[model samples]
Target: MTSTTPRYLRPGKGTKVANAFARGVTKLGISLWGSRVLGVRGRTSGQLREVPVNLLTHEGAQYLVAARGETQWVRNLRAAGEGQLRLGRRVEKFGYRELADDEKPAVLRAYLARWKFEVGVFFDGVDASSPDETLRRIAPGYPVFEIRTA
Candidate 1:
């Protein structure tokens, strides 16, 4: 069956503004609602690329959800398999393991539950209360990575 999730959604002016604000706040040691700057080495350029992301902790494990779906950072994280998350002067180096499509529903649900107000539109109306089947259907579009401290 065809997936319902969008392949990509380019950031708009508003998104750029929000990201800049989040990055600025995070740089100042202020975590805006669990936001952090994720830095991954570019797959081709070999330079670090940074972007704002929401950090989700479920059952004591931390996760990174690619709300924008198949974004550049997602590709970089896939190729590099590790990266850093920064909040002010604190930097956490981490190894990432990509969750298989079938393994993502629970994580995705929890992620939506936490950031639905900010990222729900990207999920095509699926929310924390959505059925497993619905989340499963949209899982491929949202790349979820389990973060391990390095």
Candidate 2:
């Protein structure tokens, strides 16, 4: 298995605080601009791990973009193949398929359009208006997953 740890694997203190806040908001049924709490089983421990994720909707489909790059939640989602998206007491079970690097540009673009102000730093300056070539070039660094409702 290729290590999902990206070069920018370590999240700063602010990131942690923001994530905690987002998760709390999600638990209260108030999505912070489409943010959701993702729960996936850890590959090694078989324990559910939760994290705050921005749920992106594009072309009538739902997607999950790993803004921090190949993160632990991304790895766990890959291993589990399925997970739950929670908001308040509402939990939706879903499966996901990882998008190919070449197929990520559109989804990435949409994600950037919605979250650029929050996550643009991680994209190395790429944004919604960026050309496909630019998004594709940086695609490998960010993992995009298509969510399939169960």
lDDT of each: 0.92, 0.90
Residue-by-residue lDDT tens digits, candidate 2, 37-133: 9999999999999998889999999999988777899888888889999999999999988899999999998898998899888887788999999
Off by over 4 Å in 2: 1-7
Candidate 1 lDDT tens digits, 1-150: 966655878999999999999999998899988999999999999999999999999988999999888899998998998999999999999997889999999999999988899999888889999999999988888889999995
Model 2 TM-score?
Answer: 0.93
Q: Which window of ten consecutive residues has the lowest lDDT sum in model 1? A: 2-11
Strongest candidate by lDDT? 1
Q: Which pairs of residues have clashing backbones in candidate 1?
A: none
Candidate 1: C-alpha lDDT: 0.92
